[model samples]
Target: MSKKLLATGLAVLTLGSAPMALSHLVKDEAMQSYRQSYFTLIAMNFGPMTAMVKGDMPWDDAKMLALAEDFAAVASVDVARAFGPGSDKGTTRAKPEIWENTEDFLEKYAALQTASKGLLAAAQSGDRAAIGGAIKETGGACKACHDEYKAKDYLY
Candidate 1:
């Protein structure tokens, strides 16, 4: 092949892959902020329901269902790409084991998703007792992951 032609071919190959590489880099850069925002949203949805379940707030079935639905919607988001390599950096409580022990992290994520569904179902049923039980179960699922995958004093 001509030297000029060979150079052109190599340039084409490098440029062709640049977008994919850039995309991955962007994802990694955004992961920590995105993950933090996502969890904040989840907490926003969870807080009121927890208060209601604990009798600190008056029970409102409509509000309960709406919050549960919101929680479920957030839970359903595909976060598979949100925990990419180096995502444990910055202002995150995420443990390094999340990437090292990926399977366990994924399992915990799945359990949280399942619990969200159960909470949604219980909320839709309009039974305060059922919703309370579901909340407890869901809280357990959250704690299970938090205990192992989150660092204490991480927020500070």
Candidate 2:
């Protein structure tokens, strides 16, 4: 090949490889953040759910409802703040595909947030039917995200 042709080929190869390399590095950080966010949000949300279920909170149904709402509000904040377009080596429990397919990840998160809000609304109404529906929706959202984004080892 002519020197010019070789140069052009090399340039093309570099351009293609660069993005892959960058994405690989980013995928690690993204995975790490996913694991951290998962653990954090679960800790925050389950506290109130358990409290309300056990009647441990010194609050009325209305107060429990408020706490549920508070929990949902923090859900989105935690994911948004913790995850990014990159992955980290430290995140073994998280899958790198989340950052790789960010749109889907964000969509799943939005669904979870919406369902969590529904749960809070139902808790506020003190209606058993509504609460059941909302809880199911929230569980669906959690399962959907976990099935797609989380590692199985973390689950078991």
Candidate 3:
């Protein structure tokens, strides 16, 4: 091949790959932010539910159901992409084990989603006891993953 042709090919290849590489990097950063925001949203909904369940706050069925719905919405998100490769870098507390043992991590994530659904169902029943039980189970599911996957210093 002529030197000119080879140089042109190389330039095209490098330029073409640059966007893909940059897109992947952007996606990784976005995923990290998204993961953090998602957990924050979960906490925002869960904290109040927990207080109500613990009797620290008065029970309000309407409010509980709304909160449960919010939690379920966040929990039901497609988390598979949120933990994408390289997301463990930056200000994230996700243990490296999450990427290494992705199957187990995904299973735990699914468990939390299931628990969130259970909580939603329980909330729909308008039974404080049932809702409380569901909340406990949901919290347990969250703790299970946090215990195994999150960095120790990050735990609350």
Per-prediction TM-score: 0.79, 0.61, 0.78
Considering lDDT, which of the candidate structures 1 and 2 is the better prediction for this target? 1
Q: Residue-wise lDDT of candidate 1 within 1-156, one digit each (tens)?
A: 999999999999999999875553345358876777778888999999999999999989899999999999999996757898766776678888788888998999899999999999999999889998999999999899999888886642
Task: Indicate the residue-level lDDT of 128 in model 1.
Answer: 85
Which of the predicted structures, 2 or 3, would earn the higher TM-score when compared with the native? 3
Stretches of candidate 1 exceeding 4 Å from the true structure: 1-28
Error of 3 at 55 (Å): 0.8
Tell me the lDDT of candidate 3: 0.87
Clash number for every model? 0, 10, 0
lDDT of 3 by residue, 1-156 (tens): 999999999999999899765553345368776777788889999999999989999989899999999999999898778888777787678888898999999999999999999999999999888998999999999999999898865422
Q: Write the per-residue lDDT of candidate 2 for residues 49-129, one digit (tens) a residue.
A: 655554566536666676677767776564655665434236355577776787898898889888878888788888756
RMSD of each: 12.8, 16.6, 13.4
